[model samples]
Target chain A: MKARVTVTLKPGVLDPQGAAIAQALGGLGFTGVQGVRQGKLIEIDLAEGDAATARAEVEAMCEKLLANTVIETYAVEIA
Target chain B: MKARVTVTLKPGVLDPQGAAIAQALGGLGFTGVQGVRQGKLIEIDLAEGDAATARAEVEAMCEKLLANTVIETYAVEIA
Candidate 1:
């Protein structure tokens, strides 16, 4: 099974990288870029057999180390 | 409008970061963790009114800066 994990910052968190990106866009002449928030995408290829099992395991991984729950939220997709 | 951009390393590209992540997971005692690839997720908030226009502009941003086209591929989603 293959799983895709998306980890994004919670709202109201300070994102200096996002701010820098938005500013850079303006400098690049790309108008209308108001805000930019950056996050992480992790793809895991597993030898596991069942989708349910893989999803459950990956969720554990997210909770353990893949994501920082304090400032980030994560979603998992199994394929 | 809001746009979500996912940037991932192309297949066959060497990803030292991914390898390091997998190794770290092993140290954390998470078994069955294999083939970990890390990527980026960027969310952009736009003042633009039209979804199509925002998507188009965000695509340009990805092509020019958000992604390194030589080794990474990017996908943009507008909401």
Candidate 2:
């Protein structure tokens, strides 16, 4: 089984890296870019299991260490 | 309009960061974790435009600066 966890900054959280990226894009002539937010994607390969179980396991992983709950949010996908 | 670019290490590339994450998970007692790969998610907010246009623009951004084409691959999503 494979599970993917997408971890993103929570709304209203300041993202300095994202700001830097947006500024870089503007400097490079990509003028239409308004804002940018950066996040993480973690792909985990697991032992054989159903989607439901895999999702639960990954979500637990997210809560424990994959995400910084105070300023970040996470979503899990299984395949 | 919003677009997302997912940048990941290419197959066969060594990912020390990912290895470190897996090891950290093991230390934290997430026993079922077999393999782990890490990537980046970049979200861009743009002026009103069609999804196709937004996707194309983001793809260009990925190719130019978001991804290291030699060792990374990227996918774009628009909403």
Candidate 3:
């Protein structure tokens, strides 16, 4: 099984990297952009297991290591 | 409307951030974790528009600024 974990900065968090990109975009004439924030995506290829258990484990991983809860939130997708 | 762009490091790209996290996990005794790679996710809240055009614009954003195509690939989800 494979899971994709997407971690993103919360709406109020400051994203310096994204700010830089937004500035760069305006400089490049992609002016429609209003705001941008950046975060993370982690893909995990897991061994076969019960779906509920797998989700728990992955969520633990995200909370423990993949994302900093103070500034980011994560969502997972399975396939 | 909103769209999410998930950008991840290609398999061969060196991910210092992920390596650092993996090492930290190992230090904390997450023994089964053999490897890790980190990437970026951007959530874009766009004005209501045509889905096809929104996707194209987002792809352009990813290729132009949201991701470094040299080392990453992106997937988009809309809602």
Candidate 4:
């Protein structure tokens, strides 16, 4: 099985990295770039298993290491 | 309408940011943490509209600014 985890900053959080990227892009001549926010995507290959079990393990991974709960939120998908 | 765009590093991409985070977590006394990959989630609240159009717009957004297409891929869901 393969799973993907995405983690992002919550709304209202200031994303300095994102802002900087937007500026860089604009300077690179990519215009009309209004706002930019940067986040992360994680893809994991797991032992073949059921969706329920995969969900459980992925949740543990997120809580344990994949995410910084203080500033981000995460969602998981298994395929 | 609300749409979520999830972007992740393709496998084999070296994630220095994630590695640094793992190290910091270990220093903070978190044990048994093996690997970490970071990604991003983008949530957009759009004008009430059609799902198909929302998808198109979000796709353009990802291409234009939200992601560094050089190393990342993105998926969008409209809800």
Q: Pick the candidate with the highest DockQ.
A: 1
| DockQ of each model vs. true complex | 0.86, 0.84, 0.48, 0.26
The lowest-lDDT stretch of 10 consecutive residues in candidate 4 chain B is B24-33
Q: Estimate how well candidate 2 is docked, as a DockQ score.
A: 0.84
| Candidate 4: regions farther than 4 A off | B1-79
Assess each prediction's global lDDT (C-alpha) against the native. 0.92, 0.91, 0.76, 0.73
Indicate whether candidate 2 or candidate 4 has the larger TM-score: 2
Sort order, TM-score high to low: 2, 1, 3, 4
- Top lDDT hit: 1
TM-score of chain A taken by itself, candidate 2: 0.97
Error of 4 at A28 (Å): 2.5
Candidate 3's C-alpha runs over 4 A off are none
lDDT: which is higher, 1 or 2?
Answer: 1
TM-score of 1: 0.95
Model 3 interface DockQ: 0.48
Instruction: Chain A only: list TM-scores of all candidates.
Output: 0.96, 0.97, 0.93, 0.92
- How many pairs in model 2 have backbone atoms within 3 A of each other, for residues 3 or more apart or on separate chains, i.e. clashes? 0
How would you class the docking of model 3? acceptable
Identify the candidate with maximal TM-score: 2
Could you tell me which residue pairs clash in candidate 3? none
